[model samples]
Structures are given as structure tokens and as C-alpha cells.
Target: MIAKQVNQKAWFMVLPVFLVVAVSAIIPLMTVVNYSVQDTFGNNQFFWVGMDWFRDLLASDRFHDAFLRQISFSAIILAIEIPLGIAIALAMPKKGWGVPVCLISMALPLLIPWNVVGTIWQIFGRVDIGLLGHTLAAMGIDYNYTQDPVAAWITIIIMDVWHWTSLVVLLCYAGLCSIPDAYYQAAKIDGASRISVFRYIQLPKMQRVLLIAVLLRFMDSFMIYTEPFVITGGGPGNSTTFMSIDLVKMAIGQFDLGPAAAMSLIYFLVILLLSWVFFTVMSNIGEESSNGGS
Candidate 1:
């Protein structure tokens, strides 16, 4: 019998990616860590703050308020987008010219820059010159996002939905398309209703992708800044201020480097924790499904 040799050359193919990540990701992370631990007071002067900034942030009411706002926004976005995306995907045809057209149309909003989306909506919602605002105002609706908290929240949420629902739709559509025809054929043979088929077959098949969509939307909505910043400027008494906006104000606007960096790290860790929970739950579901299938 001939001795077998293990091939180790494949690591070379991955070396470039490791190097790129270290340069692009790791180095910046270390810098942020350094900033988080030190206080700077102009003229490049620095003093060790240790965990004082973290303690202050934890005690701050502003931090709590911002976190709550972020959570609410993310929850609202996920609730609206996930079902809407699924419904749109389900309504889409599986084939034909319409498929590409529909995909292209759905993808258009996502392709627009975040700031541009905010600007478009900001202008579009103007009560005087813009079509939507003018029409609503003409109908006697008191719609002013700048002064009204509810209106500001509604505008920001609606803008986010319009811009990001396409991502969920695309992911769900891909999952839907991946299902083999055999499953549908079996459902048809069994005289199953469309609802029954969806609940029993389609939903389970798309669970993994749906989990991903939910997690991504949650994180994105939680950290949302640019759109809301441009549209509402975190105004109407900070009703629309999320964590990222607050962090920006702290770091750039106030030049509180230590506190801002600490907040940023906390924000990042929260996202990481949530993502990990989502992944673990989804993995368990997948495992349960596999075992049940067997």
C-alpha cells in the first residue's frame, strides 16, 4: 500500500484574504480600542481614563434613551419589512420577463445611497413644494416632520422600509426559488391549500434565509444614522435618535473621544451578541429540522 500525503497548498489561496482583513479590519479595531481607554484634550494631549468612560456611559440617561430608540426602530423595521418582503416575493412570478423587471425594480431603492434616500424623502415630504407633502397638506393633513415627533418617526421608518425591504425580498425570493419542484408537486397531489403548502413546506424551507434577513435588518436598523440624520437631524426632541447618531454627536460634534469610543465598542458588542444569538437559534432550528427529516 502506498503512503498517503495530505495537501497543505490550499492555505496559500486564503493567505491574501487573511492579510487583507488584518490590514483593513484588525488595525482599525486596535486603534478604536486604544481610543476607548484614553482621554484626549486638544494639542494631542492624552491621559489614561481606563474604564471611567464606560462607567459614565452606563450611568448616562442619554445612552439609555438612545438605546431604547434604536431598539424600537429596529423592531419596527423588522416587523414591517420581513412580512412585506415575503408577501412581495410570493406575489412575484417564478419565471418570464416580468421576473427580471420585478427584480430590477425591487433592487433599485437598495442601490441608492443612504444619504440620497434621505434627501429624496426629505424633499418629497415637504408640505409646500413636494408632491407627497403638498397632496397630504391639500387634503388637510398636518404633516410636518421637523416639528412633529410622530411624523418624524413615521418618515424615518417609511424611508428605511422603502430602501431596505428589497434586501429581504431578494433573499426570500432566492430561498423560494431554490425549493425543488418535487415538494410543490407533492403538495398538489395531496390536495393541499396554498396556505397549508406555504406553512408546511415553503416557510420551513426559507427559515434559514429569513433568519439571516431578520438579523441583518435588525443590525442595520439598530445602527441607522445617515438617513435619519439627514431627514430629521435627530430632532423633534431626539425622538428619532439612534445609538449611531448619539455616538456621532459624542465623538465628532462634542469631541469626547474617550466616551464616544467606549460607546462605539459597546454598540459593536451588542450587535455581535444579537447576531450570535440569532445564529445559534437558527442553527438549532436547522438541526432539529434535519433530525426530524431523518
Candidate 2:
């Protein structure tokens, strides 16, 4: 066989992107790593502290609490949003004027900025002027997110679901659209029930996009900050203080650079590890299903 020449020039075309990534991501990450290992007390003075910060962070009850809260929030949102999104997507019209209306409505929430979302919800949940709060109060339910931990938690969770579930719905809808009419036709000819049709056709066909949706939602929920911060301010006594919130309070709020840096690195690693696990398990399941079908 004759050797074929490859296009080495592709490397040159990609070099600009590599340089940009190095400057934007790699450099900042290195700075964070540098800060993670040392203590500073003004005048650009930094002293090596080895792993003391990481040790303290690991032992601290505050960090553990924040971590648990973060985990719970992520789990709750994923549990709710995935099913809700799927149901909404399934119920949507396949054609006609309703399609554009439904799509626009779904996309409106996603188009709003994070901070704007928080602000809107914050006002909407106010007991005095907010419609939701006033209606609840008029109905004699003592709903107050500002002073009640349960209310605060509920508000943030609902806020997150409102803001992000649209993303999952859109992705799932796209996946569903990509599926051929032949599958449904075959299922109809076989007289398969709705559940069986979904399980054998729709669900399996949407697996790849569902995986993407799951990963995106997980990461976003796990690191959630702005909405909760603006609405609850992690208040009602640290009830909504997630890992990202706590990290900011430590680094910027208290100016504890060393410990904050350590915590940030640990936070990054935890996210990376969990994402890997999710990808691995889901990919394995996908492969097994494909093999079985083949």
C-alpha cells in the first residue's frame, strides 16, 4: 500500500484557538492553583502553607453543609426537570400554528438573564406586592420566603426549574424531531401501547440528547449561585447556601484567599469527577442497549 500524506497545515489553523484558550483558561487556572498553595497578608506577600488550607476545608463543618445543600439542590432539580421537560416535550404539537407559540413560550424563560430571573422571582415572591405571595396570603397560607427556610428553599428550587427546564425541553424536542416517522409507523402497525412506543422508540432514540441534557442540568444545578444569592441571599440561616455561594463568601466576602482557592480547586475536582461518573454510566447503558438491539 502507498503512504498517504496528511494535512499538517490543520495544526496552524488551530494554533490561534490554542493560544486563546491558554490565555483565557489555562493562565487563570494556573493562578488559582498558585493561590491555593500559599497564604497572603497584604503587600503582595505570600507564604507557602502546603496543604493546611485543604486540610482545614475538608475538616470544616461549614464546607460539608454547603456541599450537602448543593447535592440536594442538584438532585431535586434533576428529578423534577427531567420528567417535566420530557412530558412537556411529548405533549407539544407536531405541526400547525401551535408549534411556534409553544416553542416561543418555552424559549422566553431561557432568554432572560440569570440576574434578571432572580430579580423577577424575588419581586414576584414578595408578600406585599407580588401576585403569587399576595394570592397565597389572601388564601390564608403564611408564605414568606424572606423569613422562612422552607419557603426560601422552595422558591429557589422553583426558580431554577422555571429558568432551566426549558433548556431540557428544547433539547428533548429537537431529539424527538430528529426521529423518523418510520418508527412511529412501525409501532402503530404492531399495535404497541403508548408506553411501549415511548420506551422502545422515543426514549431510546432520544438517549444521546437526554444524556447531554442531564449533564448540562447537573453541572448548572450543582454550581448554582446567582439566582439563590439574589433571592434568598443564602439566608433564613444558611439554608440555601450552596458550594458556589459559600466559596464566594469565603474568597470575596471574607478575603480568605488561601482557603478559598483550595476550596475552589476541590469544588472543580468534585464536579469533574461526578460528571465523569455520569458520562461513564450513561455511555455504558447506551452501548448495552445498542448491542442488544443489534
Candidate 3:
């Protein structure tokens, strides 16, 4: 057999990306790690603190509350967006002019910037001049997100659903399109019910895409800052103060560098851990499904 040499030129092509990542991500991460273990006083003086900040954060009630709020927000987002996206995708026309119209409409929300989304909703939800707020007031519902915690939470959750559900819809629509026509024909021959067709065929086919959607939604919802910050300012008395928002307050608002750095690292690790668990559980389910069918 003749020996074949591998191409060494690929590494050169990838070097620019590697350098960019190092400059953009790696260096800032290293700086945060350095800050995580140190304390600073005036006159640019510093002292070793070594996990004290992390310990305090772990013991703090505020930190626990922020974490719970973050988890709750992500949970609510996933619950609302996933099934809704799937339903919308299923209802969309598979072919013809309506398909483009539906797709374009779905995509428009995603095209808006996050800050702009928050601003639009903020104005839209005002009790004075905004249409939604004015309509609700006319209906005699006392709604003010600025003063009510429940209202603020509801506003942010709805804003997130409006913004990101299109991503899930698009992913799921692609997944459904990938399913061969033969499967539907088989179901038709078997006189399968619509629910059965969905449960056994569409649902199974969408597992991988659903997994992707779930993970993406979870991470984004967990780390959400810009939209909620602009809309609610984490307010109505810490009602919507998620981990990222709280972390920003600790770092920028309070100038608590050590604690903020520690919290950021912890935040990253929690997201990483949960994503791994989701991927592992879904991959196992997929494998079992494949084996059972075989």
C-alpha cells in the first residue's frame, strides 16, 4: 500500500480564527480568573483573598434568590417556546406561496436587535399611551410592570417568547422537511391518527432538532441581560433580577470585582453543566429509540 500524507496547510488557514478567539475570549477570561482570587483597595493596592468571595457568594441569600430567578425564567421560556414553535411549524404550509409568507413573518422578530426589542415592548406595555397597555386598561385590568412584580415577570417572559421562538420554529421546520414522504405514506396506509403520526413520526424525527433548540434556548434564557435590563431594569423590587443582571450590578454598580468574577465563573459552569446533562439525556434517548426500532 502506498502512504498518503495529510495536508498541513489547514492549520495555517485556521490560525486567524484561533488568534482572534485568544485575543477576544481567552485573555478576558484569564483576567477574570485573576480578579476572582484577589481583593483591591484604593491606590491600586491589592491583596490575596483566595476563594473568600466565592464562599460569601455561596452563602448569600441574594445570590440564591438571583439563581432561582434565573432558573425560573429559563424554565418558563422553554415551556412556552418549544411546543409553541413546533405547533407553528406544523401549521405552516409545506409548499407554495404561503410558505414564504409564513417563514418571512416568523423571521422578522429574530431580525430585530435585542435592545430594540426591549425598547419596543417597554413602550408597548406602558399604561398611558401604548396600545397594549391602553387596551388592557380599557378592559379594566390594573397593569403596571414598573410597580408590579408579577406584571414585570410576565412582560419579560412574553418578550423573550416573541423574540426567540422563531429560532425554534425554523429549526423544527427544517427537521420536519427532512422527514421523507415515505413515512407519511406508510402512516396513511396504516390509517394512523394525526396524533399518532405526530407522536411516532414527527416527534421522533424532531428529537435532535428539539435537543438543539432546548439547549440554545436554555443557555440564552439563563444568561439573558440586554432585553430584560432595558425593559424592567431588573426591577419592581428584584422581581426579575436574574443572575446576569445581578452579576453586572455586583461588578459595575457596586465595584465588587472579586465577587463578580467568582459569580461569572460559577454562572458559566452552571450553564455548561446543565447543557451537558441535556445533551447526554437526549442522546441516550435517541440511541434507545434507534435500537428499539431496529
Candidate 3 error regions (>4 Å): 1-16, 42-44
Quote the lDDT for 15 in model 1: 97
Highest-TM-score candidate: 2
lDDT of 3: 0.94
For TM-score, candidate 2 versus 3, the one ahead is 2
Question: CA shift at 86, candidate 3, in angstroms?
Answer: 0.7
TM-score to true structure, per model: 0.94, 0.95, 0.94
Which portions of model 1 show Cα errors greater than 4 Å? 1-9
What TM-score should be assigned to candidate 3? Answer: 0.94
What tens digits encode model 3's per-residue C-alpha lDDT throughout 13-126?
Answer: 999999999999999999899899998764667789998999999999999999999999999999999999999999989999999998999999999999999999999999
By TM-score, rank the candidates, best first.
2, 1, 3
Task: Give the range where candidate 2 is weakest over 10 consecutive residues by summed lDDT.
Answer: 2-11
By summed lDDT, the worst window of 10 consecutive residues in model 3 runs over 38-47
